[model samples]
Target: MRVAALDDDVDQLELTKYTLQAVGHDCHVFQDGDSLLRELRRESYDLLVLDWSLPDMSGPEIVQWIRDNLTERIPILFLTNRREERDIVEGLSCGADDFMIKPMRVGELVARVQALLRRVYAEPLPTEQVWGRYKFMPIGRRLEIDGKAVSLTQKEFDIALFLFRNKGRLLSRRHLLESLWGSSNPPGTELMSRSLDTHISRIRSVLNLRPENGYRLSAVYGQGYRLESIGNEDYEADAQLAQSQA
Candidate 1:
């Protein structure tokens, strides 16, 4: 994934860039939110890592703007020092998918960025995904689970398709906002978030799955929503360890 970092702290920004690159992702850097926003207008990136505090706009505010004004959905990660409960919630409420408290370990940040990218962009296609007992054809995008065919809204279908493809990646809320809502007029917090939630609710209702453990969509506390199987190396290590224990 092509990831961008926006921070006033040059040292941290470079460290983030280097760490992500070492882990096989392309990265870019900006010292402030405004410059990053300008760059957003000119290019496309799979992900953005921003600081919560900036000279121009807070990362949360910038994310809202991207949702409203831009034509694309770019996953946003806030690499800020703000760890107040309300502050983190505000970031997610404003459309940020993942929030990283500043002075974060490099490995942890890289893993998280990868997790979001996998969730939002690199989800694997399902051999077959059934929604409400309706099995879907991946290639043809047709639904037929119970012998009877079921219809879906266009966005609903897209949601199903995306979920089916990437069953295990955790996607951040800000990232989902971009993926589902796209950037238009650099959206305000209210518009983008409400629109995203609406889309999610619409999808959930159509599938008729219990909200408690709805289909593939699961919440990852302190990060974002993830498909059932998405995670990092530690997750892999745990799996290996489990096998050893077994």
Candidate 2:
């Protein structure tokens, strides 16, 4: 999980970073709420670990900002010294999913994080998924075919996942570029569009995606590209017929 942690205390922030990283989470720490909020605007996070008292803003205020602005579902966990019943209620009312008093126990903290993630995000998808001879581990960004690992660059993996998730849909060059490169070409400057074709070609070669292998990645004339599943007999017959006519 990608987590953003906010605490004014330097020592506490470091400890939180170490503890969360120990549990296989990528944690970024901030000394003030403003810095954390700035990072939040640019990147998406799965969870937020907040301190009630901060130099700039209170934890509840940060929570409110997140709830108001961010589109992604992010669970907030408050790690603070406030221990009164009213304090807990206020934190919960402000949209924090869980609250823990300071002097936190690492074990309990980790457990609460896991519980909140499971409850809010619904298990976060399995680490590995198998489709016939292909195996994908999105968390590790790894792919394997028939037990042999295939190396992929970061953008290649991102593109492959995007295509696989949207298989059977015609993904336009604009959509692919925006999805992978974060932006599409401006008016009259479609030169960068060819980059998508290159990536698609590389992905098809690496994955051995073809009609014979139960997968086909094909261009759609003036439309775009489609990744089709040809595993069924009807689709196989159609593919054979198309080949014969060509």
Whole-model Cα lDDT of every candidate shown, in order: 0.70, 0.81
Inter-residue clash pairs, candidate 2: none
| Superposed Cα deviation of residue 18, candidate 2 (Å) | 0.6
lDDT of candidate model 2 versus the reference: 0.81
- At residue 108, give the lDDT of candidate 2: 90
Q: The CA-based lDDT of model 1 is what?
A: 0.70
- Candidate with maximal TM-score: 2
Off by over 4 Å in 2: 124-246
